[model samples]
Target chain A: MLTSAQLDKPIVDSDLQREIEHFLSYEAHLLDTNQLEAWDSLFTEDGMYWIPLEHGQEDPVGMVSIAYEDAILRDVRIRRLAERHAWSQQPPTISTHQVTNAIVTAHDPTAGTLTVRSRFQVVEWRKRNFLRHLAGGYVHDLIKIGEQWRIKLKRVDLVNCDGVHDNFELFV
Target chain B: MAEADPNWVERLVEPARVHKAVYTDQRVYDLEMERIFGQAWVFVGHESQVKEHGDCWSTMIGKEPVVMTRDSKGDIHVLYNRCPHKGAKLTAEGCTKHKPMFRCPYHAWMFRMDGSLVSVPHRHGYDGTSFDPDDPQFSMTPVARVENYRGFVFCSLSEEGPDLKTFLGGAITSMDNFVDRAPDGEIEVAGGVQRVMQRSNWKIFFENLNDTGHPIATHESSFLAARKTSKHKLGGEVPFQLHIIEGNGEAPEFWESLDLRAFDYGHSFMTAIFHAPKGKISEDYKAALDTAKGKEEADRIVSMNRHNTIIYPSCSPHTGFHQLRVIRPISINRTMVEIFTFNLKGTSEEYWQRTITYSNIVNSPSSTVMVDDVEVYERCQEGMESDGMDWISQHRGEGRDNLLDREIQSEGISEMPIRNQFRAWSHYMLGTPASIPTGGGDS
Candidate 1:
């Protein structure tokens, strides 16, 4: 459990901030290259990937969401992307995630937990001239395991999270 | 617009084959809006959506914007969203609690929740003019008919058609089972609505609701993914999340073993392939229902597990999961689906959470299972645009259907439901009186 004061305190260490920024950029590279399995490895065993359907939606269990996946569901999603019969991926979606404005919102070095917030815009295109622009804010909760950082929770708050969308085959 | 020849409908629809023009022609689509959607009973919203007095939820019936409101007396009404003054829309979108009355934003003209004109600013200026406040034209105009069956509200744009009950026909049992499974014999639309846009004809989505054959092929990617994950992690014992997705990969024999029933007015349903397995959630829910409605009634209610019940031209309700996917046709090539999850009144919080989970997994836009389904629908739409094929086949198990007095039942893999829908479609397109067949065993 994190205290309010701990969550509000920003990490002033420049080295830690650079490290977190590099980690996010690497994750974005994995997603853009469609290396979903490698991307999945960035999370802990019980990590969560959530996309709230409504703005400021607090609870995933009580409300519907664009996505709310634990490790098992994430595995299913990754596996589906590689299936030959996945008609939606017949012409696989190509996306370039531009992650910017990285900031270390909170850090508790003794607890091995750091919270980072960043803004991202993902431009995606697929066959049949289907193109979409997805812009959102990402809130990542990371925990240091030894010298390595693993994602505990990754929450995406899209500008149009609640708006009607076509198939969302790939991760944001 | 020139009048479409009556033969056009008959030429487009056959017993087991339909012309691609029925799906791709803009003229036919427009005629459908006037003939089919104009006369059929379309679902507006659930009564729970506007529970309190002065609560309003805006939705669409055909192309017309409609507002479902609850008056001060708690009576629900469905009125056109257009304000009588300057034709401005009453509400922008979504639900709002406008206590007492609704005020038009264009002018200060106010109207009761039931669409009765309340008052307008400077009313004396219109006393001698053509504007008459007493006339219904001066206020919001209500749809021809609005009816609620077990808290599910439906409205018809035309006044000459059959009532909601008659239009629902034998498919009303799905509604009964939905509410009856609730311990308190009711449900409320909880959790928020998830909307998805499909680049396909509305009827294509409707046909796929009872399409058991397509699941194995269309959803191979999703089911295979779930199977792989379950085998690797859970050691072959699939959990609830994977179970629903993997069920689509069932063999042809499994689909053939299930039952499919089609009724009048394009309504149909397929028996649930996956039952609520023996688990803590099922046990607790059953116990609650047993306590509320006695063991015998609870057993009966739980026994009627249905996968998707098509209300025809409006929505599909999954009674087993307490979710409704309402279909709103945007154009000949585009459609919008709004998914609403319902909470059974007396169930445990865990039980209601299952509804949310099922909806997010299977119905949400990002759902692995549904993305493939939407993809195929889009592919069908794209393929139909080509000039290569004139007719789409519906010949699977055509003559094998057992046509009873009231409903048509066939093998689970039959295309009887599609043919049955066209039967209603042709009837409506040709402007024939709808006569629901009566006399079948209530299975």
Candidate 2:
């Protein structure tokens, strides 16, 4: 499956590269620090965050995805996580995420976008030991906002995304 | 001799309730495969999954590896994955084209898709003996019965039982309405499959499909956080994400008004939540329906607003969401749920995307809503293991279940659904072939 030949692959300049690194770092910080508020700011107003249920998923129109979220749904999830009575968070998950191999593999300078391929390993801990190693390529679509750069879309493709999961409390 | 517990099952189940041991006991888990999961009409993959010849999908029935395959004649066959030559697994996992026959990895014994012994490598060795390949015992064993309803394939392991249609009974409507929502009045297996493992009893998950009492209390923290985030993060303007979060926090009256109906075989479905304002996509979808299905038919289809319809011990079809969470009990303490997304045959692509979106937010491993639910289920498993209490309560609105012909109705928060399931559980555990209670004498 050609994953967004135009979208999955983008062009990145040095400035764009720097912007993506910061965007990637900030996104990780928001989730790891449990500062979902800050993370919510990363998306474009109409941007989508989609996680396909199947490998090599091509289109999202008629097919069902594992997760496809707009701004509103994303907020609800963040809200649910922060709720004091959230039963799953009786002992909230503690995680230290390591984001590595940030490469600007593709760029779309005219579109103001760049796709970065990166590997990540997050060690998440809760009451009992739940440590998962997730390595994925991140497709980042960025747009310039005056001097700052904001994330339009950031899709993470986990290497073992197809495996049975317990629950994704925090981000990868 | 490590004889299986014959009386252990009888002791675990009661007329009106079930002991948690039926859920968490290892000895009982083995018996379930032989009795319930083995005999019951368990759902395999949809026919669309293996539409072509040599196409096969491997899944488990209890502890057995049952393969749903398409033969050369385009007939569907469910066969045991074992090869008779050396007792080796004949096929790899997932769907794969095995050509005309499957060859065992150990000693090469090839079998046709219909589970016939096509060859056994050195056939001359068996010529002197009575190991004739034509005998049924020499071939891969086919399931007792296989039936398809609206492209959904279900197989039963027992030779004697009510056919799949009679077994599905009223639940067939859910599958019909499932594909009928497709403008073309058909649906296909599409998108992807999401699998989630739960550290609790399979019954607990089944009960939660319509368990209205827990959403407010169990999901309080998540919804509260959703509310708080709207206030602090995005200036109090709720989005679809936040809407789903707070949707779980509906008022008690709202829950009480909605109808919950249970069928004889422990199958049940709830009327859609009375809230959730019709949004842009839904409005667009309604317009499309008016064009495709016309005003009356479309209205009739839309009027059947239902949540999850449990097909009893196997899967829960969310008609509104266009997904099915197929449950497989891996062990007494663990259950595996595979989420399959379906494409409405004639609807626009965007309509399906919304369904997928709902699946991700509500059912995905990273779902904020389901995370908390999974946690509580695990907690229940842990709590039940302790000797503090022997019986898990199902007394909520016990005697108050409203009875009707072929169906029982209860209030939104009533535990009648759980009690209804236990009624079936007792029947199944007691080894009664008629698991569906007649609901007349002593129930």
Candidate 3:
């Protein structure tokens, strides 16, 4: 009951799969390069970025998450990270992400929506701090709007989601 | 490091300042674990967490591992988590449900939910060996004292001390108000707990709870971000989420205008800086409260708005937001905080959702607001390692205390809460009871 979404695996053509892979890799590139505003534009207006505290947490409203951000919160975090007085970001965190294993989990041609699952490992570092290695899986629910793909939902599940953690200053 | 003199411990804290060693030294931290956490009433878990018989929740009181369990005949007990035989922890960490009895994984010794000996694996071998199952030492040993204050459970490691209510002193009103605000007059810990590991001393987090001076300087980035987001995104109308963040941006005069009250045993609370929010959700919650409780009583309950109520050395409860942060000191420079969000039993689902939202925004490790706070705490801890300074000031509003019956009242910006906490700290470390004034005027 607490597993990830149970969707039938659909065979997608090579071009569509390449496009999806490109979109995900571009998203990771934006994060790695600290292009937060560009990353913010990838989400639909009411889209959400969630990192559930518990594995297989179905309800964001009823259960707490490490992060369950809407557009406004994402903006607030981006703005804060850019602030000169953002002490936590003093020597801002730098990271590189490896996003692989892109698999198409679901497809809806009529609704122009697709679900892609991928695995990610991020090596994040800040000056005068320990280097953090974060491994998580991403579940992207994407929708096509006028030939552009926008994220409807991006769910990140860290391997150690339930463990005690230090400050997570940036979006995972 | 050399062993600290008893006289040095006495001199480390004064009426207006504390020595830097209190925050930086390993020896002092060892003493604190012994005197303060070992003797004081430490919060364990809420009764609601263990509602059914044979349900258990594992947690640590200071460094002592203990478990809270509900018995078959409907009783709550706090027992040491270690098995009596080979000293293995009886249960794994976190909560478990519907266990008929606690069975040791090592020797397979079984004990009842109330921690009485039920059976041992090799009965015939123990029969000739003078193994006394009836002896208390053979079973999972309970802690010295356990008390439940309106479903908030606490335990003391010492056999002698004030009872839980007496130790709580004037802080009981905040606890009372927490439950009374619930429409069903009952609240339960729900949602899941978020654990944040801090690279600073435990007292640094506790002191920041009532330290009215730091938010404006320490939280500038987050608050400014909130204000900027409000202006750009919502046409200057701050939503509830942004409002909580930008609230720290209130004028210093606004913070100074509120009231601060400090009790005897290191407990204190500041009056609400954010009033009962005016919105459709709040109005609906108020209406439910008015229905369950009388309108007048409900209004009274809502009027007792408070920011953070410090129960001293253990937990801080934000009654208005329905959140509790339990502090666990891991080492001299390491602390772990467990944040728990509560659900008012009879409130609408939207109201409960708001509680979860507040927890995510303000208390979670990923919170933009708390990131700055934690950063500042870490900076303070690191900066104190210098030999440059020897004392931390608690002298903001020293001589202006107005002594009430059992609490000391001061202006909002005063450091009286910190001073009052050290007063209790000195007493505990020096092996004396925290003396509370009996009458209204100064004694």
Candidate 4:
């Protein structure tokens, strides 16, 4: 089971809190503006983007998931979205993600790693008529390399994770 | 029983094309729900899903609520998921494990796993009424017929029809090969299920299963992305992950080289375009298979590789990938697809993991490949609403199908499968027997 990082202590450092909040907002901004390539760049080389189908899904392998993608799979999706004949994206799905309630549960100063949990609600509009409302919880495992914090894992647990869904053309 | 138009269905479905009403009209959809899905042996849950006594798995057989349950005697039965008194569903949707007995939340009516009425809350209230506890009407009703072929259970609403084996006809080989690949000669439904909703008619999705002509055009975006990623990042050696995607970019000649076989009852399958991945995990899996069922038998089982085997309007099983996609038609313009990945028993954990990877990459709604297919299906549904055309064409390779005793073989890119499906559709809707139509290539 992939659990959240240990809760070392509540982040009392104002500077560290501000940096984490900025990073979360910027990530949401990239997704909202359809800057997928830039969003992809925010991840580490071996990072994973996972959306578990089960509520408390422990293993991404040996079980089915909505998504359990590595860098190559993520890049393939990004490249396909750029294709002119990508039929699903003909009109393009426009989304606005509202991410809030970010709580830094754990911060390892020595290893430069942090585990942050946030809540998000995304409204996606497509085909000029269909509007989908999706809400989920996000868990990010961030690791700092040099000066920048890169995502080692981004786990999304949707409220309706076990329900039927339409094709998700874009990342949530 | 009376005919509304007498010729309403026959006029719509011809040898080469079908009227747009078949895909768009609500009347046609209603008729199909009653005729085709009502009579055909539809796939219910597998036996493994309801292995324990009192375990129940709920699903629909053409919008009819039904549940598959294992009784105390170890026999599995398919029953209508409704309360005998109030007509409310017996169990909630999906699987409910170890359900001691079905206690209806509606009226507190209880039933055994075999659907026999056990007790009711107000037992003394029906003293003088026609509600005889010993009568069959008081119990949950089982479907007319239930058959389990190698643990894959199927149900038919109508009592009279060809048996499951006969209905499957030449397509039975696909199911046989599916179970034979298991090291222990058994496979079970495992992992989890992913459901995808498509805003299109159910037939459109079925037609696309063997429509070899579409991949090169429909899936160009995904295949091209896979190629670019392989070339730049993976040093031109496509891994199994990208190999499945890039395989869609095969040359036109490659698709034509495939062997396409269409059976009676709208069933068909295409020989796999993907070669077995040459990797350590796969090698170990093959060795295990060889050990279980002698080397020669294992070789024969592995050699029968296939991509999509359509068991007609219900499910499509990919024998090579260990995936089964169940098709559920929600309404006229809406369809729900549930994908299930199987675990071949006695295989390594890594072998099962590969199945999970394949499902996540190819069958999930979030798949880069299926999104395009779903989009085009929706486009066809929307375009059929246009008054520009009356008929959708299936003229490719029309006169070139090879006639056989029970099945037809055609070129991979041929539209024979679509035509064959309409042939079955006309039979079901027109109330004709499912015996091969005179001109439909069956001798």
Candidate 3: regions farther than 4 A off: A1-10, B1-4, B436-443
DockQ of each candidate, alpha-carbon based: 0.87, 0.55, 0.88, 0.86
lDDT of 3 by residue, B1-443 (tens): 23555487877888899998989998888888888889999999999999999899999998899999999998899999999999999999899999969999998999999999999986898777878999999999999999999999999999989999999989999999999989998999999999999999999998999999988998999999999999999999988889889999899998899899989789999998665568888999999999999999999999999999999989999999999999999999999999989999889888999999999999998899999888889999999988898889899999898888888899989998888888888888887558655445433
CAPRI-style quality class for the chain A–B interface of candidate 2: medium
lDDT value, residue B189 of candidate 1: 94
Question: How high a TM-score does candidate 3 get?
Answer: 0.97
True contacts kept of each: 0.93, 0.82, 0.88, 0.84
Report the error of model 3 at residue B142, Å: 0.2
Question: In what order do the candidates fall by lDDT, top score first?
Answer: 3, 4, 1, 2
- Candidate 2 per-residue lDDT, tens place, B199-260, comes to 99888899899888888888787778777778877898776656766778888988887789
Tell me the TM-score of each prediction against the true structure: 0.96, 0.89, 0.97, 0.97
**A-chain TM-score in candidate 2?**
0.81
For residue B424, model 4's alpha carbon misses the true position, in angstroms, by 0.9
Q: How many residue pairs clash in model 1?
A: 0
Residues A67-167, model 2: lDDT tens digits: 56667667666666666676787788787777776777656567665556677777778876565566666666667666556667667677676778888
Off by over 4 Å in 1: A1-10, B1-6, B436-443
Docking class of 4: high
Worst 10 residues of 1 chain B by lDDT: B434-443
Q: For model 2, state the Cα shift of residue A63 in Å.
A: 4.0
